[model samples]
Target: MDINRMQDKIIAEFENLATAVNKFSYFRHLKKISNGSQPMDPEDKNDRNLVTGCSRKVWVTAYKEDGRIFFKADSEHSITRGLVNLLLKVYSGHTVSTITNTDLYFLHEIKLFNYLSASWMRDFLSVIQRIKSLAIVQHLDAAPRS
Candidate 1:
């Protein structure tokens, strides 16, 4: 699905779900869809992909293939894992331009930002920035050297 459709679907899913329990359950569902069987390894969990400022360790990795982006992530906690999974669901398989230009306004519409602490918010933004930076680097690398 396109980014717009995915955004709307995510907003609707979160808005439709009631209670933190349900929300977390839905996030796990998304994680299952994204992560499948193999998850990030212990060795890969280092300073490179680790999301700083989070209460728990979170690692996110991104790559590009045939102009489309892919992401893999894992977190020390279930809730954060779910969050990363949700983001990857929306972000992965898109072009660098699409990923970079997209706005994550649905996060606010889902009321997730409201419940986040200052540190969590910083970590959340860091995840987003990491994703965009990866896209930027990939785009630049793919560009023809003039």
Candidate 2:
């Protein structure tokens, strides 16, 4: 029921996961988003916006679009892309406040933290925080006066 449990279940599903399979999965997510879904935007059109925490070449972009926070991401590896999809499914479609305030401790409950080393964990957390901050700032900017 919690993010931790849910993450464990998800991990169990991927316990035998090969990195190559993850690569293919990212392509699947991209195709799915490209078909009709709105993927999160990368922060820049250039190489500057790319996320550095990932094992592969990854880019994550976030924008407060409509009433929802839309995230578009891409990775040079399939599994990493799948990871992005997993993050998107959990983090997207919520309002900025919702995303910012939610007990993301659920990720810990899901055991999503084990695979990474400390540095990677720090970067990953930084990425999540950045996305939340961008969404919150955008929302405040767009809010109408009472």
Best by lDDT: 1
For candidate 2, lDDT tens digit of each residue in 32-144? Answer: 53344344444453466576554456676766768877677666555455555666656766787677877655455434565555764665665676567667876887889
Task: State the lDDT at 143 in candidate 1.
Answer: 85
Alpha-carbon TM-score of each model against the true structure: 0.79, 0.59
Question: How well is each residue in 2-109 modelled by candidate 1, as lDDT tens digits?
Answer: 987888888887766665545456555545544442487777788988876667788877777998888888887766677777778788889998998898877877
Q: What is the lDDT of residue 124 in candidate 1?
A: 75
Q: What are the C-alpha RMSDs, in order, of all predicted structures?
A: 3.2, 6.3
Off by over 4 Å in 2: 1-48, 52-57
List the lowest-lDDT window of 10 residues for candidate 1.
29-38
With a 3 Å backbone cut-off (N, CA, C), the pairs that clash in candidate 1 are none
The Cα error of candidate 1 at residue 78, in Å, is 1.1
Local distance difference test values of all predictions, in order: 0.75, 0.59
